[model samples]
Target: MRPRGIFWPGVAGIASGALMLVALVVTYGNSPDYEGRNGLRETVEFYRDAGNRDLTEAMALVMLAAGLLFLFFLAALARVTASRSSLVLVGGILFVALTMIATIAGAIYAITASHTEAFVVTPGTGTVALLLLDVSYAGTVAAMVGAAVLLFAVWRASRTTGAVPQWLAWFGFVIAVLCLAGPFSAWLTVLLMALWTVLAGVVLVLRPPTEA
Candidate 1:
């Protein structure tokens, strides 16, 4: 396919990145940390409000949309890579899968918390909620592994075929490395990924590869 095919996907990637930032902001601004044991207590207390649940559900929906858009972005990159699309496909699939898992896990926690009557605070309720939250966070980190793989694929393709500029391709390498630190840096990985996707989108749209 011609590089022209990348235009819509590149646009979608930019939108995805914007939505990701929105989701990140909503999450941090509206929700409790939900990190440690104390965070669990905060989560329990915070979700007592119906408004919080509504906002969380909205954020989850936004994130789901972002995930799908990111997939479209990856598909465009894979199309450009042609025969080398396999690695991109693998990585994108894994990334989207984990994103789904993480979003669902968080949504379930928020949804469950909304129904105080249905979700009575048993002695184990807090622990279960905490586990769900942990799963969401850990799932995000695991998803970064897939993102790294996808980026590495992009970097290799760029190096071989000059699909993208050398500096931007190396920036992919930098973002991939930052992805590894997702576990330690809260939503820093999300921020970097968003920036990279936006930049990639602009590059793809403005400088269509001659060979792809």
Candidate 2:
């Protein structure tokens, strides 16, 4: 088999992850003290600074698109893996759902962050916005769990069906473990996930399914 449906999903995953990474780097740069610093008041100030609002909104939009693309990629992955094992399919589905929640929460936070004036004046609104942002972090835990499960599923499938290379499955396991380190390791997590996704996509595109 040529892995007919894998090409588009791989492309989508690569594009989605790359776009989000670029957006984050461009918007935040080297500044660790950008948005969500000090407290709700500081966060409001960060966004209220005029120049930051446009960038914040733009970044949010990019992330939103990335999230949508990731969903599509996950759906395709689910389809591809469905015949190998039901557990693997479920893992992909769970990953998709959890990621969607995280993405939506992040977008909401970005929207709220952009509206600096509204949150600045309305005391509690900033807190609410900050809370929403935190919700995304919470969602990441679930997403990581899903990623781990999916990786495990892939590992198991690879062992029997040769659906993916053993090394790729192992790499996924490593990435999944790194992802569990939480917000402190977020940068590493994102980089590893993006690399894995791109590599997986490329492999699926270049190799015949039967070859694996």
Candidate 3:
């Protein structure tokens, strides 16, 4: 099997994660004193000023595209585990799709916070700045959940040597968990996820062929 739609969801996932890490750097550079900004208007200004809005927005879109690819990869992987049960396979696909939507939405909303704006940003009120942060928070959470479930689906695929590699499966699991804490250390999450993609590609290439 040529792995159907794409041969590199895991790789895509890792690359997208790296973009986010870069976005974080771009965002942090612009965010002056987060704690000191006590007004709603100021907060918005802070994020826009701290980040290269254009770069951050473009990166956000990239993250969304990568998330979508990851879901497709999960679907291809699930086929190896479903064992002829169309119901299980369909359900698995649904889960991946839902995760994709959630993650994309989150990345878009979250990344928008990092851009150039004329307003001053502060942490005081429920302003646009705060809202963007909240959206990002929710989005990251959704992406994390999706990754966890996708890992399980792929694990089932990895049950036999002909489908997925056991080590690669484990690697994804670790990366999924690390992504959850990306806000704390985007660089760390990006590194691990990058390793996951490379390992996944190697696994897919090495998987034993199944009877047609």
Q: Give the TM-scores of the predictions, in the order they appear.
A: 0.88, 0.76, 0.58
Model with the higher lDDT, candidate 2 or 3: 2
Query: Where does candidate 2 stray beyond 4 Å?
Result: 23-37, 79-85, 109-124, 180-187, 209-212
User: What's model 1's lDDT at 168?
Assistant: 75
Total clashes for model 1? 0
Tens-digit lDDT string for candidate 2 (176-196): 777677776655665566566
- Considering TM-score, which of the candidate structures 2 and 3 is the better prediction for this target? 2
How would you encode candidate 1's per-residue C-alpha lDDT over 1-212 as one tens digit per residue? 25667888888888888888888788878877677558867877767667888888888999899889988888887887665689888987897789779878877866766655678644357667778878888888888888788888889988898777788779878878888777885367767777778888787677554574
In model 1, where do residues sit more than 4 Å from their true spots? 115-117, 121-124, 208-212
Count: clashes, candidate 2: 0
State the C-alpha lDDT per candidate. Answer: 0.79, 0.64, 0.49
Highest lDDT model number: 1
- Best prediction by TM-score: 1
